[model samples]
Target: MDRFVLTDAQWAKMEPHCLGKPTDPGRSGANNRLFLEAVLWIVRTGSPWRDLPATFGNWSTAFRRFRDWREADVFKRIFDALTEEPDMEYAMVDATIVKVHRHGQGAKGGLRARPLAVPKAA
Candidate 1:
């Protein structure tokens, strides 16, 4: 019933498409709704997860879940589903293309532990 959290309609939109394993049951009725709220908090405030308010679940738990969702491809599916239907015949690119700096490759090591958001078809 809280407007700050996802409403039933939003949950329904997500429920049908998300096939990943649900969060494990801990204390009875621990539905991990806070997990979702934590993610929403991150977007709403754009704060580091460690700075997430204690009213939400542990920051590490929320972040681990966020990273897990990234690894599982769940976040991409949600993004693709929530986006307005693509223009089949028309595409838009707003950015100027530029060659990568020589230091760009230095960032490769940090990426080894996380899945990058690379386009599948590219």
Candidate 2:
């Protein structure tokens, strides 16, 4: 199963905001898209960096790069770029599917229960 989360259009939107273009002074990122995918995979699966797939390259390297990007606000820039035109297709919440338990609906003897008064000291 393909685990990649970024579509080509999304990647294009975020590409310019990523660090390490050949024009930058420091060493360019080997493959920014793959690195971003690695980070996304970790997030999507809620897995620790140590469990990153071998296809994403060394887990440590990916983690370190993620740290750098976080500190540099690269991810924020990418998010901003993508949100320029938000997609609301999956944003709706269905009220019918949501359930309120009896306790949650202010059932008797819950928060309404009065606390017993402390005995007066002699």
Candidate 3:
């Protein structure tokens, strides 16, 4: 219902391992439909897990599942499985390009680098 649900085509594009499978009895529970929906929402909207809508189930539950999946190497496996292999025959080629006038890489600044301006007393 107006949730960031994944279309059939998109779901099919994902790795089979990432898809929901038949859950066993007892230890098995309600399908993780809402959980997957929440994850899809996050991937689509790039929002934090805590920002997940309550309608998609508890944010903590979704986060826990995410963590579990991550710990179980599900994410990597999914990525590998869904990814297509490059089409290239057995061939080795190398090329080198020369460039002049190179500058040092920029440094990353931290929060400490940015300070709020102090207001003057009126």
Candidate 4:
């Protein structure tokens, strides 16, 4: 798929957790992977639903599907499945070494005071 976000392996992990599979009794979701990509696009760009591009399908339909998934907690299950094993290799943070400039720590006189003020000419 063009402009794809989830790799094949990642989609494999999440596919089983998604609803409306062809094997199921109810209506099968049309292109679940594409729907997921649409949702991801919205999140990645932080854009409003109306701004969703035409490539991902109708924005309203995708939004409704997102709401349904949210209500079913499908996203949580997907997240849990993908994060079963915590990868800490790149998650480490060194908080021991830190530096703060003097201006950052409520400098003398504070920032509320105006540094320059000029009288208006009549």
Candidate 5:
């Protein structure tokens, strides 16, 4: 399989947070690192679940696993475990709060169907 960029240190940090571990009650995941890489591929590429490559295993299974993890707060724990204190040095503006420049504005009136004027017979 192609290298997924997840280093050993990173995987170490994330390992405990994942489900289907051998120590856990039910079936252990086939390969957690591979599954994570598959998930990362989907997230990075913003592709639909159905488009997941065969190398990742069944797309439906991966998606179902993803959904289960999401509901279980597994991802949230992983983020909390991996992230350090947020950097406040840079100020960020909300996109909704920004005003559009005049040149960037759309047509003066909002889009709507205007009644067609009937030509009068001369």
Candidate 6:
């Protein structure tokens, strides 16, 4: 799979916030750019971690790294930094184009009138 590549401007924004730099105390990450690409691949394709391509390294290692970064809030920081300038121009949504499934419309009797039983605690 062709991995996602961050633009120079985007990388500049995220570089400082990422973990495992050469100056960092712990074992340095193999390559922050490649790691980001691996993460993007998972998110973009919506694939299970185990399906990660061999070029990205072991799937389990990537998943563990992802968990560690999540715990440290690195993803949130990157999002905030990159989205600092809100692009309101493209924010408008056309509700008319949206569709809802028939079964999701709720029962004929409505929600409140439906018979609901409370389970007894075991």
Clashes of each: 0, 0, 0, 0, 0, 0
Give per-residue CA lDDT, model 3, range 28-110, as digits (tens): 13355556677778998999988998887778877877887778777687667555664555454444444433343344542
Output the worst ten-in-a-row residue range by lDDT, candidate 5.
21-30
Q: Output the number of the TM-score-best candidate.
A: 4
Model 4: residue 120 alpha-carbon error in angstroms:
66
Model 6 Cα displacement at 59 (Å)? 0.9
State which candidate, 3 or 6, has the greater TM-score. 6
Indicate the residue-level lDDT of 6 in model 6.
87
* Candidate number with greatest lDDT: 4
The 0-to-1 C-alpha lDDT of every candidate, in the order given, reads 0.66, 0.84, 0.65, 0.86, 0.83, 0.83
| Model 5 C-alpha RMSD to native | 9.6
Model 1 bad stretches (over 4 Å): 19-32, 84-122
lDDT by residue for model 5 (1-122), tens: 85776999989999988888755553236577888898899999999999999998899888888888889899899999888555666567777779888767887766789888989889
Q: Which tens-of-lDDT digit does each residue in 1-122 have in candidate 6?
A: 35357887999999888988866554336677788889998998999999999998889888888899999999999999999998887777686766677776777765566567888899
Off by over 4 Å in 5: 23-28, 85-122
Give the worst 10-residue stretch by lDDT in candidate 1.
24-33
RMSD of each: 18.1, 7.1, 16.1, 10.4, 9.6, 11.1
